[model samples]
Target chain A: MIEAKNVNFYYGNFHALKNISMQMEANTVTAFIGPSGCGKSTFLRILNRMNDLIDDTHLAGECLIDGQNIYDKSVQVDELRKKVGMVFQKPNPFPKSIFENVAYGLRVNSMGDKSFIAGRVEESLRGAALWEEVKDKLKKSAFELSGGQQQRLCIARALAISPSILLMDEPASALDPISTSKIEELMYALKQKYTIVIVTHNMQQAARVSDKTGFFMLGELVEYCDTKKMFLNPDKAQTQNYITGKFG
Target chain B: MKHTERELQSLKEEVSQMWKLVLSQLEKAKQSYFSGDIELAREIASREKRVDAFELKIDSDCENYIALFSPVAVDLRLVLSLMKISSTLERIGDFSEGIARHVIEEDCNRMPPQMLEDLQLDRMFDMLTGMLSDSFVALESENTKLAGRILAKDKEIDAMYCNSIALIDRFLSENPSFIHCGLKTLLLIRKLERIGDHCGNIVEEIVFYVDAKVLKHGAKQNKE
Candidate 1:
C-alpha cells in the first residue's frame, strides 16, 4: 500500500506537484494520466524518491509506504528504493549479457548466492513475460534483443529485486503496438504480486490497464476515482474535456 | 470547432431533421383522419421510407464516429443517445404510418362529430404532437429542463386513450350499426397512445444525453 498525504514537491522554486493526497491499494494498478509536463511522472518518482537524484529539488509533506514515512530522516533511501523498484520510459539495460542484465540487481544488492541468483533470474524473466524469448540466449548481449525485448529485460531487471511496488514511467511509450500490448498484459499479470503505479500518456492504455485512474493537470490532481467512472462520466468538467480531446 | 465536434454537430442536425419529419408525419396522420384527406395518408405512408432511411443513416454515422474518435463521457453519451433516439423516432414514424393506414382503409369521417369529440381523439392528437415537438426542442437546445414537463404529457395521452376505450364501448352499445367504425376508431386511438409512449422514450434519451442520468426504468418505476 502507498499513500501520499498533502504531498507538495518543488523543482527549485517552481512547484512540480501541488498539495496532493491519494492512496493506492496493494496489488491494484493505479494509473496517472495527463498531458506532457503535468507532473504525473514527477509524482510517480516521488513514490520511490527517484526525484532525489536531481539537484535543487524539494519535497514537503508525507509519502508513506505501508504507513512508514519514506521521506523521514531516519528512513534509508537505498533501502526504500530496494523496496520500491522503477522502470523508465526507455529501456536502459546494462551492457552485460542477458543473464547478467537481470542478475545485476541481485549482484549489486548482494542478494542470494550463485544458484539462488540463477533461479531468481529465470523467475524474474518469467515474471516480466520475457523468459521464453530470451531463455536460450542467456549469455548473449542484452543489446542483441529487440526494443520490446530490451524493455522487458528492464522489467525483468526491476522485478529481480523482488520489490513490493513497481513504479513504471511510461514503460511502453517507446515500443511498437504489439510490444505495448505485451507490456500492458505484463502489467495485468504483475499486479497480482506487486502494487503497480504507472504514468502513461496513453489514455486508452490507462483505461484498459488500471483499476483506478488519477487525472493530473498543471501539477494538480484534477480527479481520482474508479477507472470505469473516470472514463464513463468523470466528476470534473476539466477531466471530461481533457479525456474527450476538447481541452484548450 | 474540432473535427469530432463538427461531426457530432452534423449528426445532431441529421437526427433533428429526422425528428421533424416524423413529427410532420404524425401531424399529417391527424389531418387525414379528421379531414378525410386520403391523399395525405398516402403521402405519410410513402414518407415512412424516408424516416427509415434517416434512422439507418444516423445509426451508421454514429457507429463511424465512435470507431473514428472513441469518444468519452459526454461525447460518448451523446452518440449513444442519438442512436437510441433515432431508433425511437423510427418507431414513432411507424405508428404514425399505422394511423394513416386506418384513414385510407376506413371512412372515419362518417362518425358523428359528437362521437369524435366524446372520444377526445382530437385533444389526444394535439397533446401527442405538442409532446413530440417539445421533445425536439429539448434535444436541439441541448437542455433537459423540458424533460419532466414533456414526459408528464404522456399521462394525458394515456388518460385519453383509456377514456376513448370506454367511450367507444358506450357508442357501440347504443348504436350497434356503427360497431365496425367504432372498433376501428379504438385501434386508431391505440396507435396514438403508442406514439405517445415512444415520445416519452425520446425525452428519456435526451435527458440521458444532456444530463447523463438514466430515466428509463427509473421513470417507469416512478409512474408505477
Candidate 2:
C-alpha cells in the first residue's frame, strides 16, 4: 500500500510535481497517464527515493508506505528500494547469464544460501511468466532473449528481491504489440502478489489494465478515479478532453 | 478527426438515418390506416425490408466497432444505445408494416366510425407518431428532457388500447355481421399499442445514450 499526501516535488528551482495526492492499494494496479513531460515518472521515482540520486532535488510532503513516510530520515533508501522495486522503460539486464540476471537481486541483498537463491530465482522467473521459456537456457546471456523476454527477465530480477510493491515506468513502451500484451498480462498476474503502479502513454492500455487511473497534466493531478469511470466518463473536462484525444 | 470518433460519428449517422426511415414507414402506415390507400400500404410493406436491412447493418457496425476500437465512456454508451435503438426502431417498423397489412386486408368504410371514436384510434395514432418524433429529436439533440413526455404519451396509447377492448366487444355483440371487421379493428388498435411500446423502448435507449442511465425493465424513468 502506498499513499501520497500533498506531495510537492522539485528538481532545483523547477517544481516537477505539484500537490499530487493519490493512493495505490495492495494487490491492485494503478496507472498514471498523461502526455510526455507531465511528471508521472518524476512522481513514481519519488516513491522509492530514486529522485534522491539527482542533485539539488527536493520533496515536501509525505510519501507513505503503509503508515510510515518513506522520505523520513530514519528510513533507509536501500531498504525502501528493496520493499518497493522498480522496472524501467528499457529492459536493462546486467551483462550476465539469464539465471545470474535474476539471481543478482538476492545476491546483492545477501538474501539466501546458494540452493535458496537458485530456488528463488526459478520461482521469480515463474512469477514473471518467463521460466518455461528460458528453463533450458539458464546459462544463456540475457541479451540472447527477445525484447519481450528480456523485459520479463527484468521483471524476474525485480521480483527476486521479494518486494511488496512494483513500480513500472512505461515497461512495455518499447516492445511490440504482442510483447506489450504479454507484459500487460503479466501485470495482472503480478498484482496478485505485489502492489503495482504503472506509467503509460497508451490510454487504451490504461483502460484495459488498471483498477484505478490518475491523469496528470502540467505537473498536477487532473483526475484520479476508478479505471472504468476514468475511461467511461471521467469527472474532469480536461481529463475527458485528454482521454478522448481532443487535447490542444 | 480521431479514428474512434470518426467510427462513432458514422455509427450515429447510420442510426439516425434508420430512425428517420422508420418514421416514414410509420407515416405511410398511418395513411394506409386512415385513407385505406392500398398503394401507401404497399409502400410501407416494401420499406419494411429496408428497415430490416438497417437493423442488420447497424447491429453489425456496433459489433465491429466494439471489436476494432473498444470505445469507452460516452462513446461506449452511444454505440450500445445505437444497437438497442436500432432494434426498437425495427420493431416499430414491423408494427407499422403490420398495421398497413391490416389496412390491405380490410375495408376502411366498413368499420364503424363510432367504434373508432370510442377507441380514440385517430388520437392514439397521432400520439404514437408524436412520441416517435420526440424520441428522434431527443436522440439527435441528446436531450433526455424529452423522455418523461415520451413515456407519458405511451400511457395514453395504453389507455386507448384499454378502451378499445370493451368497444370491440360491444361492437361485435351489437353487429355480429361486422364481427370480422371488428376483430381486424381490434388487431389494428393492438398494433398501435405495440408501436407505442416500441416508442417507449426507443425513448429509454435515448436516455441511456444521453444520460448514461438505464431505463429498461421498468427502471425509474427519472428525466434529466
Query: lDDT per residue, candidate 2, A1-248, as tens digits?
Result: 79999999888999989998988889999999998989999998988999889999989999999989998889999998899999999999999999999999899889999999999999999999999999999999999999999999999999999999999999999999999999999999899899999999888899889999999998999999999989877878888778767773
Tens-place lDDT per residue, model 1, A1-248, is 89999999999999989999999999999999988998899999999998999999999989999999999999999899888999999999999999999999899889989999999999999999999998999999999999999999999998999999999999999999999999999999999999999999888899999999999999999999999999989999999999999973
lDDT accuracy of residue B96 in candidate 1: 92
How does candidate 1 score on lDDT? 0.92
Model 2 is docked with a DockQ of 0.52
Cα lDDT of model 2 overall?
0.89
- The TM-scores, chain A only, for the candidates as listed are 0.99, 0.99
lDDT of 1 at A188: 98
Candidate 2 off by > 4 Å? B1-3, B107-109
Task: Give model 1's docking category.
Answer: medium
